[model samples]
Target: MPRPHGFSYEIRNDTSVHITHQGRAAATLRAGRAAAFLAEVENGDAQLVMARWTGSYKFGNERTARNHPRNRR
Candidate 1:
């Protein structure tokens, strides 16, 4: 069997690509990095939220990608 609905890429302006799966935020890729994200997704090297700490992908509407896995203050 295969995934019913896999990743979906939405180009937000000229330098961004927002990736979504089943309506979740998933990942937001910037510039040419979109291709790299796609390649990862394609090659099964990463999942929707795989780049959990990558500055390259801005996840969620609140831009929580950077602060994720928050460090103790």
Candidate 2:
């Protein structure tokens, strides 16, 4: 199945996790690793960031993250 927009951590029946970003699959990690990553995120070992865009995709802007709006909060 296609991925969902934004961030999501989905656990599969086999105990593997599917990580998605911007409607795309970014990574697939084992359940153990996934848990560790989540722990890191919670402990501040990782920084989670997101960006959004406007102009209805008509701006023809690049998909590069450097141009996306950073999360200010």
Candidate 3:
């Protein structure tokens, strides 16, 4: 699968995390979630981490599902 891109995050002064994808707001994490996300992001791919946090990460089955016999239009 291709690596996820276009994901960025900002830490607000109030300790909230604002996550964006392709320049649009995708998720806002506050308090406990924000703390956890910061910890994980520091240890892994930031883009992938953001994508996963926003529930937007691909699971590697998209192409197969798209071309499956039953999916043909």
Report the number of the highest-TM-score candidate: 3
Name the candidate, 1 or 3, with the larger lDDT value: 3
Count of steric clashes across candidates, in order: 0, 0, 0
Candidate 3 local Cα displacement, residue 38, angstroms: 0.5
- Candidate 3: lDDT over CA atoms? 0.95
- Per-model TM-score on C-alpha atoms: 0.40, 0.44, 0.89
Point out where model 3 deviates above 4 Å.
none
Candidate 3's residue-wise lDDT over 1-73, tens digit each? 6799999999999999999999999999999999999999999999889999999888899999999999999
- State the local distance difference test value for candidate 1: 0.55
For candidate 1, the 10 contiguous residues with the lowest summed lDDT are: 52-61
The 0-to-1 C-alpha lDDT of every candidate, in the order given, reads: 0.55, 0.49, 0.95
lDDT, model 2, position 10: 64
Give the range of the ten consecutive residues with the poorest summed lDDT in model 3.
1-10
Weakest ten-residue segment in model 2 by summed lDDT: 49-58
| Residue pairs with backbone overlap in model 1 | none
